[model samples]
Target: MVPSDFKALIQRFYQLQSERIETYRLFEEGHEAYLRTGPHYDFEHYKQLVHEITQAFSGISKEVLEIKGRLRELDQADLCEHIEKLQSKEKQKLELTAKLQLAKQQAQDHPEDEGCLEGIQEIKHEIIKNKEALSEIMQDFKYDSEECD
Candidate 1:
């Protein structure tokens, strides 16, 4: 059978997935380093990480959305839906992370208070859960591409 024209889109989607995974790992490391409980809690480093992650997130989200609609047009509605779900989760994570950054910035003014890290772990856990679900979706995407062969 001839290869499907949509195979390139699928490969691009995988690239987005990989980029997100790399960014998320960096985020997790930054988060750990920013916590007061950690020995290397540098406010400046955390701030830089937040900025980097935000930029990365924006880029990935833009591409994911573009691919999402394109996938739908290519008659891959199921794959589109899966990506949309992941997109939604990623948006939620980004929003919560922004809020966390704001809280941390304020906490910097009051180092005596230890409430800054309150919900950080919760948000991280939520992201991990969503990520696992999205990984399964990616597996489905891989199988879906088999039709292209």
Candidate 2:
């Protein structure tokens, strides 16, 4: 029989993914406001949002990854591996997002600061490199979960 804790852990993982989708909506809203803001975009706000949620998600993912051994013991190795891959990719995207926000803040805070715009350009390139990774993973999880679908 599956342990109650395992079920709970899985539930937490899906719950986090749902929250991530809502988070994406917030990002999209901010993105669409580009060129419309009066003084500046709210990079500071998003920076804090990214930092806090990333920390929280990292903690949850750590717990989930630790439980994977038990998942394998219970013959759920495939699911365990999938989570491992998705988590790594998601981490990369989150890191770049944090960097992008910082660059935006730097540019906004000091328009005269050298390289701030270039730095954001570099981060955007990295984001474009694997932009589809998150969407692909989301689609895969969506098929299996009712959380973010």
Candidate 3:
């Protein structure tokens, strides 16, 4: 039987992928909405949105690297460190994903105030990219595990 932790990790990866796709869909919605809003909204809001999206993208890219590290065969200390980083990064991604979704919802609910819609789009795009990268990492992990068996 597979270790519980490893199995759970694989499940979590797939779930993250699904969520990432959903984020992309939401982002498309945000882009269309932004076009509809025209220039009535403050440009500062768009800039802020881009900034937040950039942060989320950076955070997810970092997490993908951590996950790749965790998949490597390493000593106990290194494994522990990588696992910790993976957990931390996962938590951060979840938090940012929730924040992005909330921002998108708020924008949709209040079309008059695009607020953070631009940031939402950025988050969605980042999620799509990161999700693919993470999935590849997970596949590599699986293959490595199988090779060892």
lDDT of 1 by residue, 18-96 (tens): 8987997888777756775444457787778889988998898899889888877777777787787778767776676
TM-score attained by model 1: 0.67
The segments of candidate 3 whose C-alpha lies over 4 angstroms from its true place after superposition are 1-89
Q: Where does candidate 2 clash, by residue pair?
A: none
TM-score for each model: 0.67, 0.57, 0.42
- Rank the models by lDDT, top first: 1, 2, 3
Question: Rank by TM-score, descending?
Answer: 1, 2, 3
lDDT of 3 by residue, 1-149 (tens): 44555545445545544555555465455545654565474446555655665565465556545544544423224433434444454555656666775676577667787556777788878767655654555565556445433
Model 2 Cα lDDT, one tens digit per residue, 14-46: 776676656656664664454245266665765
- Taken over the whole model, the C-alpha lDDT of each candidate is 0.73, 0.66, 0.55
Clashes per candidate (backbone, < 3 Å): 0, 0, 0
Q: Which candidate is the best by lDDT?
A: 1
Better of 1 and 3 by lDDT: 1
lDDT of 3: 0.55
